[model samples]
Target: MSKIFLALFVIILVVFFILNINFPLKKHEIYGKYVNRNFDKPICCVEAPHTEDTLILYEDKTFESKFYGAGTYILYNGINPEIELFYKDFNHSSSAIYKTYFLNGIFEKPKIMLNADMNHYYEKLD
Candidate 1:
């Protein structure tokens, strides 16, 4: 009985540690390192760090930018992949996209959706 209890306890501890832990942590900053000359500089980088992921743009509302967007980011393809992230909008999807080296173009195509009709995708000039 003592051995069984000890084993169960160890298993629980391992699981607990695994679930609460993140690995190969992709360290990112609130402000991205790069800048775009033509477009407005990105307002800010997300606080959450990720090694492999995507961000979708949408029309309006402040979950993110002025565009509707979705993301489905997973770091691996295992029973317990180390990372997980995603977002999506049914009507309009990602148009401007970002690519990563690891996925090798399989999940490489990020997109930006131009939501002009729904709620005035962009603010109008007075």
Candidate 2:
């Protein structure tokens, strides 16, 4: 009886480990928990990074973004931007810069920013 019980326990443990490895958990796949704001009209939509929450709210006459589970706002005062993006591996002191390319008309360079930059270049989906 003891031998049978030990064998059963080992089998259960092996099965559990196999299942866990076969299907690893993904980061923030649940969209309902990630809904930032409901708007009648939105300028742009943010495709959030893994394991993080993306929030873009209108404040101080500018669109500010708070990312990485942190509720700090990043100013967005430019015209229609090419895109919005964020970095999850920001090791800087509570701040970092991101640069992205935009479809600037017939011929133009990619829009760039130094620190705390968020793009507003795309139309919010209907």
Candidate 3:
């Protein structure tokens, strides 16, 4: 009985590890950096550290602008793909805002059209 239990535990651990490393969920399709330019450029603010604006969507539904900072993002995939990022204040104030963008094209070659900025769109880069 002890050997059987140990073997089962080992199998479970192996399966978990494999799933984590190999088979990520469909929701993880947005896990990547979407950038407008090749180089970093400041977008959110003038004093922003980065030069290029880049949006990063993680597997855990977290996001970061890199130029501004990290935040939490939500993707509502449907007939019209939508993503919203709740960005934390740069000044460390207890303030956050949600910015929505429409996701376009395939997951691999995605382009995000920002509701705030109608002029430009962010393209996914690997």
lDDT of 3 by residue, 1-126 (tens): 999999999999987765544222245555798785423333553332334687788888777786547878777776566777676666778656555455543233556654223334567787
Global lDDT of each model?
A: 0.30, 0.33, 0.61
Name the TM-score of candidate 1: 0.24
- Tell how far residue 93 is off in model 1, in angstroms: 31
Q: Name the better of 1 and 3 by TM-score.
A: 3
lDDT preference between candidates 1 and 3, better one: 3
lDDT of 2 by residue, 79-121 (tens): 4332233334355454433444322232222222212133333
Worst 10 residues of 2 by lDDT: 24-33
For candidate 1, write residues 23-66 as lDDT tens digits: 32222211111211112323333322212223322223112322
In terms of lDDT, the poorest run of 10 residues in model 3 is 41-50
Model 2: residue 41 alpha-carbon error in angstroms: 28
Candidate with top TM-score is 3
Candidate 3 — which residues are off by over 4 angstroms? 1-26, 37-51, 106-108, 115-118
Q: lDDT score of model 3?
A: 0.61
